[model samples]
Target: MASSSSSSSLKFTVRRCQPQLVPPAIPTPREVKPLSDIDDQEALRTHLPVIQIYRKQASMAEKDPVQVIRQALSQTLVFYYPFAGRLREGPHRKLMVDCTGEGVMFIEADADVTLDQFGDSLQPPFPCFHELLYDVPGTQEITNAPLLLVQVTRLKCGGFILAIRLNHTMCDGPGFKQFMSAWAEMARGATKPSIAPVWRRELLMARDPPRITCNHREFEQVQDTLPSSDQNLVQRSFFFGPLDIAALRRLIPQHLQHCTTFDLITACLWRCRTKALQIEADEDVRMMCIVNGRGRFNPPLPVGYYGNAFAYPAAVTTAGKLCRNPFGYAVELINKVKGEMTEEYLQSVADLMVMKGRCLFTTARSYMVSHLARLNLKEVDFGWGDAVYGGGAKAGAGRFLGVSYFCSAKNGKGEEGIIFPICLPAEAMERFAQEFNLMLGNKSQPQTSSATFIMSTL
Candidate 1:
């Protein structure tokens, strides 16, 4: 794509807007410590970086979105004030919020561009991804940090993009959506939040004497080194219409037909990603699927608990076997691990980390995918009409070989489907696209032998 095409660097001017602090009367909780497993001992890593794109509110075109959102955010922060706090570097990579209500970084920018410039593509590296998101100033190393940053960019045609850059550890998808929902409701004049925010992480803390109940590979204490991926990366978006996703489901065995929308799509992506990279036969390839810890918790955490309740349960296998196996093999592997994300599994994870004593995540020969379909982004109205299009912006900010997020979108013909913003090495991306298309194109021919189908595409 058009995303990386040097079609004139996206031009924009940013006049740093006034910083917004937590409402004066809002109460701030005392600072909390990081989980004992601090990869901080090894590297200064920040939370998973994320951004969401929202089109301008047509009816409120003449209204001051900045003023509206700022005021609303301030009010919303009264209930979710921790987001206004700043992160303090503890030991290297580990961080704890100061909870002093320092406030979030806010910016206002203008571009001599129109939403049309993006031409239906929402992958990042588009003109605004850089201008609309903020990276902390100073050593440019992980030392400088902020809890949240919001950018409102006004386009020339009276349209605007609401870009949000926030730390992942502050909340999971539901928690973040709750915060945004509260802000939106406040902007629309809600006297109170729809859901009260809660912070009871201690309830789910590791048990004394650390009970171990799961045999997960993650529960072991081998102290394995994290994997590393290539530094040269590019992002692109792929759309799978309702029909395309259904076709993928049909590719698997009949008994496995109940595969989830995420499972079906990710299996395709994992295979294509592997083929694109052309890893050696003996090399190991891994896919880390994010699992929600909220449901897995015993007596599940409060529906309103605003904290990190996500886990990356991985599925690993050699590249040779991955490419050679039937499509059902990958489907079974993905579903199997996803099924293991239970309360027991989480307890074992807490206990294992307490014993091994380190936060370990890898960046090499790996791919991580998350589907935000539950965010129901299209239904998220903020006085402005529902977003023309909105989802995660693919910022290549971390060491992961590939980072992908999926969300619902209306294809060109207005058919319902999902848009996946994917980031991978440039060359790998080309192979990825070809493989993805080939797989979809083969759905009409269901009888093709699995080996024949995979090899012919390769």
Candidate 2:
């Protein structure tokens, strides 16, 4: 129960069959394939769970989702053979796939509940999320474990929920999406995927004499300024619609009006979160922006190259400067980090990873945000059309080590917008909501001069 509130009291029992490994449809080559330096980073050696809910379609009323997906997954593994292998660690803690053709873990389940019973809002944190995709005990490790775990829970309403727990070391969000899309194509009777899978991870390998070119502030060690207690932390999702976005945009200067939606909203969240925590004004705070490097390269990585190709370029500033400064101040810091997403910067990161022994991103008084609203995960269809809800199973609550996601979702009123979840102590979460609501409701722009002193005390 990582849910934000206890109001989600709806409960149901699910009957699950024995878990089994589904190997590739045909025998594949057996060899050792090393992962890119970026892929073996300690920060990515964990599993990430994603859920997609599909409603029953009248045209495919008699089709069995479990069987279709099971068959499709086996066919998919033949091409994406790395997923059918197990991760192995070598000297200096480097990771590589053993190409064992051992296959992935799959489970079939039937839940005594309908899609509508989950409530009007299909957003996370979903009730009984863990049951939707059980960890299966020893399968949670990074090395010598199934690269992917999938559970297809058929609902009483003829709809089925597709839950997948993928090892982050294998691929990123976009990479995972590409794999799923190909699997869906197979389920739809495609003999082969439209786009072929490519394994040129060596392209992201570190240079012989690794060079640290740029300032890697994202990995800098710092002090944790907030209260040490992790208990009483609660997670909640907030919706920002067109009107809400308009109000937030009004807070920034007219010159920054053209800033992307992610820049605007993320800046606002960082400010509001800092204010709510009541952190010391002199302490430094950071906002780690996850930038995708696929398009940043000179010629770009190959299509269907499913690997970790992202970086967390951080923006650092003192709490006093951040909370008291004009709204554009935060936006400017974010833009600067995003602008640094070049081929050289990514190569520099690979060098840094190898040099630093693959350290985790700094979380000292920092908030991390990833924009997943545009991933079009909702469009993934396994013959039933779009999913009613498709994305991370849970938003906050340390599911992503305090990283919150901006997902595309429709509110209970059917208004489509961006929904993101934040985790904070109970009292801090209350204050955060108040501060955010005030900003959203205020039509006038903030006066930096007069509000500077007043904002720091918030």
lDDT of each: 0.64, 0.82
As a whole number from 0 to 100, the lDDT of residue 342 in candidate 2 is 85
Deviating ranges (above 4 Å) for candidate 1: 1-58, 89-95, 136-144, 218-231, 395-397, 442-458
Relative to the true structure, candidate 2 reaches a TM of 0.93
Rate residue 127 of model 1 by lDDT. 37
lDDT of 2 at 106: 97
Please, what are the lDDT tens digits per residue for candidate 1 over residues 324-370? 99988998888887887887776666665555544555555667787
**What is the alpha-carbon lDDT for the whole of candidate 2?**
0.82
Q: TM-score, each model? A: 0.84, 0.93
Q: What is the lDDT of residue 285 in candidate 2?
A: 90
Tens digit of lDDT per residue, candidate 2, span 1-458? 21121233466777788889999999999999999988988778878778899999999898999999999999999999999999999988889999999999999998888888777436665546667887687898899999999999999999999999989999988888889999999999999988898889899999999999999888899877566655566656777888889887877898887788999889989999999999899998989888999998879999989999998888999999999898899998887788888889889989988998988778788888888787878999889999987887654322334677887888756778887767677688778888888878853222111111111111
